[model samples]
Target: MTDVLLGIDQNVDRAVTQAETMLDLFDATDLDANLLHDFVDNPEGASVKQVDSVKRARDILEDAGAAVTLREGSGDPAQSILDMAEQLDVDLICIAGRKRSPAGKALFGSVSQSVILNAERPVLTCGSPGDEA
Candidate 1:
């Protein structure tokens, strides 16, 4: 049983793409995926199930026969993902990487980069559909 923590953002395309990539990369029957959505600004107290990206990802993974669980987090997105990964003891942490300029990243910070740098376990990043190399 391989456990995976799939960090889903608001990008529906990226989330679905990552889910499809996972199905192609692993045996769905042997995979257990936790779909996580972090509400960075949760004044309204949003739930993970309320996020379209997480819900779509869950549907794709579950349809492929992967055991799927929904998780919610509030705070820094990268930190939340790392904390959940540690708590779940997942074998892999998967996230979507969006292309950002160096200056943009310097100012805004990159969640994928932070998770990759700080994670104790392996982190797999899937680029968005039209991202260039």
Candidate 2:
């Protein structure tokens, strides 16, 4: 019974796309909580968006026969992802990557980069469709 932590941000469509490509990796999944962490200051709006995002991912994964339980968290995206993965002790971490220019990444550090650098477990990253990798 492998536990997979599917890390997602506000890009619900991109997350769905990544899930479609990686769900087969986890043999047996009974997601206790579909963790949705908001990395924004405004709690109210962020919570609403987080719920919607989690529900979308939940629906997509559930349709594919994955049992999902929705959960919520707060703070930095990368930190939240790492914290959840560690607390849950997940077997694998799947995260969706957005194509950002080097300048942009320098200006605003990459979340995936942070997780990949700091995570103790394996991190699988999927870029958006048509992305140059």
Candidate 3:
């Protein structure tokens, strides 16, 4: 089956728009990534919100009828995202965020930018629900 990697982070709260898009765009195995801990740990209580975010996003995706496997990544967010994509050798990658102007992109380097620049596979970027083209 085709494999698709979805790179998610704290911005995941805004990923619904992109996730839904992917649902219609591809018929593939979906892999989700959350670089919550540099080292694996039990995600409980209130210590790690990132883990919680991943779980919530995973639930959302699953509820939407997309079967997603959450992958745990370590180290830099950008590197981890690429590493997971490479390791899984996914056919495509999907990430979501608000559209940024050129100046905004230059002011802050984004994970999506880094992945789009470096990943050998195709990358699908999704913007906010009401974002203009």
Question: Evaluated with lDDT, which candidate comes out highest?
Answer: 1
Poorly placed runs, candidate 3 (over 4 Å): 28-52, 101-103, 130-133
Model 2, residue 80: C-alpha shift (Å): 0.8
Query: Which of 1 and 2 is the better model by TM-score?
Result: 1
Model number with the top TM-score: 1
lDDT of 2 by residue, 80-128 (tens): 8888889888877878888889998999988889989999999889777
TM per candidate: 0.96, 0.82, 0.69
Give candidate 1 misplaced runs (Cα > 4 Å): 131-133
In candidate 1, what residue range of length 10 has the lowest lDDT sum? 124-133
Question: 36-75, model 1: which lDDT tens digit per residue?
Answer: 8998898987788888898899999998899999999888
Ranking by TM-score: 1, 2, 3
RMSD score of candidate 2 (Å)? 2.7
State in Å the error of residue 54, model 2: 2.4
Worst 10 residues of 3 by lDDT: 32-41
